[model samples]
Target: MNTHFSLFRLPETFELDNQILEQRYRTLAAQFHPDKFAAASGFEQKQAVMMTATLNEAHRVLRDVIERAAYLLKLNNIDADSPEHTHFEPEFLMQQMAWRETLMDAKLENNAAALTELAQTINQAQTELHRNLQVAFSENHLEKAAELVRQGRFLQKLQQEIHAV
Candidate 1:
């Protein structure tokens, strides 16, 4: 895997400075943009295109908290993307189901206030999970980090569902 942190000259951590990331992205983008090599040889242009694509992908993965965490896990030989790697605790699973039911109920009743409140609640949970994830990473607790990532993914999906409704 290409190290996105290396590409952006950033540290390999969930906590990042968005301002510095944006600046690095823009600098690399301008340097690797295909248009800059439009008059160059065909091979040079193709290389530029590939580099530009890589830069964009690296920037995207590093900018998002979830993706960045997953990438870090991957670097540590953890298969975070695999289904078998995700094993949420029973309590968390039950809570997820209850949240889903609440979402469904709010939708059926056309309750905008309820949906808004649910979104807020989920967002708070997501924030807390992120904090836990940071500690997990710092402590070298890959299993705990992976579990937090799974919960974070659930909350993210729930947030999207709330938005769709």
Candidate 2:
């Protein structure tokens, strides 16, 4: 484990046990929450805010299955930063391109139904990607997990585009 986990003081124990995580999260939140420093010195309050922000970020990452898996992979010395680690299945990439085309077509035609369909498709992909992420993480398949993260990023981007319409 690198200093990244230490930066947030997040547990480095690969324990996915939710009970332990929840307790740790709550303890950190309580300790760093800005409200708890309402009467502290200015510097203390600033430090509390910074700590709280870090704690909140950690909570967000830990609470999300995909993010948690990605973090764990990083801890395991996996080169998740590069797509070179895994060859993304070409068929899936082509499918994603088709979906992107659909979204573009929908936007150009101002078709509400098409936008809705695209949203549904992206949402389904997100679900599948999350499931894959869990499996990849549990099996220590870092390359596969990284590919899923990339796919998830595109799906999320598409989701935002749909909403912007």
Candidate 3:
């Protein structure tokens, strides 16, 4: 499979300029739009459809940090997505429990304000994870990057729960 970064002519890195990715995605989408190939042979139209879908998927993966991190891990032959199989550090695991307790407590108390504040704190933690992932990737520390990717995933899910509350 062609890498997502190569589709957008980007380097495989944790940090990307999302604005530029969106612009390039638009250009690629327009170029491969099925309408543009409507008058062409059936094969050509099919090709256009496939290309458009690929571009859409690539854009979706590249624009999100968590997805991008997973993609990077995949490229390195690492699996970070399966919570049941891939174990996180004990400290992080303990912290995850604490975060969940805090979130549950806020919900039990019916404190939207506390939930919102907790969400903000989780967002900050996610930002830090992203930053650390960049350093890990830059140093070719794929294992560390994969661990951070898992942490980010947990934080993202926790934040979603907070918002749901």
Candidate 4:
């Protein structure tokens, strides 16, 4: 698989300038959009369609902090999705459980304020994790980076659940 960084002509780092990524995506999308190839031959049109798909996938992956970190780990020979890599610190696991229970309690009580506070707490942790991920990637700490990405995934799912509530 082509690395999303290479596809977007970006450096392989956890910290990315989102504006640049978006601009590159727009440029690539405009270049490969099917309408631009409508007058071309069948093979060319098909190629454009494939390029468009690739561009979209690249944009989607690179635009998200968690996916981008996971991608960086994969590029560095770490499988973030592997079972071994899924192990989080015990404290983190306990914290996640506490957050989940709090969320449940908030929902059961129909307390929007509590839910909002929990969401904010999760958001703050996510932001900090993103910063830590940037440092980990910069220092070539692949294992640490992978762990951070796993934590990020958990937080993201929790955030989604919060939204659902």
**Model 1, residue pairs in steric clash:** none
lDDT of 3 at 120: 85
Native-vs-model 4 lDDT?
Answer: 0.91
Instruction: State the lDDT of candidate 2 residue by residue for 94-144, as single tens digits.
Output: 987898899889999999999998899888889888877777766777777
| Clash totals in order | 0, 0, 0, 0
Once superposed on the true structure, which residue ranges of model 3 sit more than 4 Å away at CA?
82-85
* Model 3, C-alpha of 120: deviation from truth (Å): 0.5
Give each model a TM-score. Answer: 0.94, 0.77, 0.90, 0.95
From the highest TM-score down, the ranking of the candidates is 4, 1, 3, 2
Looking at candidate 1, the ten consecutive residues that score lowest on lDDT are: 79-88
Model 2 gets an lDDT of 0.75
Q: What is the C-alpha lDDT profile of model 4 across 40-155, one tens digit per residue?
A: 99999999999999898888888999999887788878888898766779999999999999999999999999999999999999999999998998888888888898899999
Report lDDT per candidate: 0.89, 0.75, 0.89, 0.91
lDDT of 3: 0.89
Off by over 4 Å in 1: none
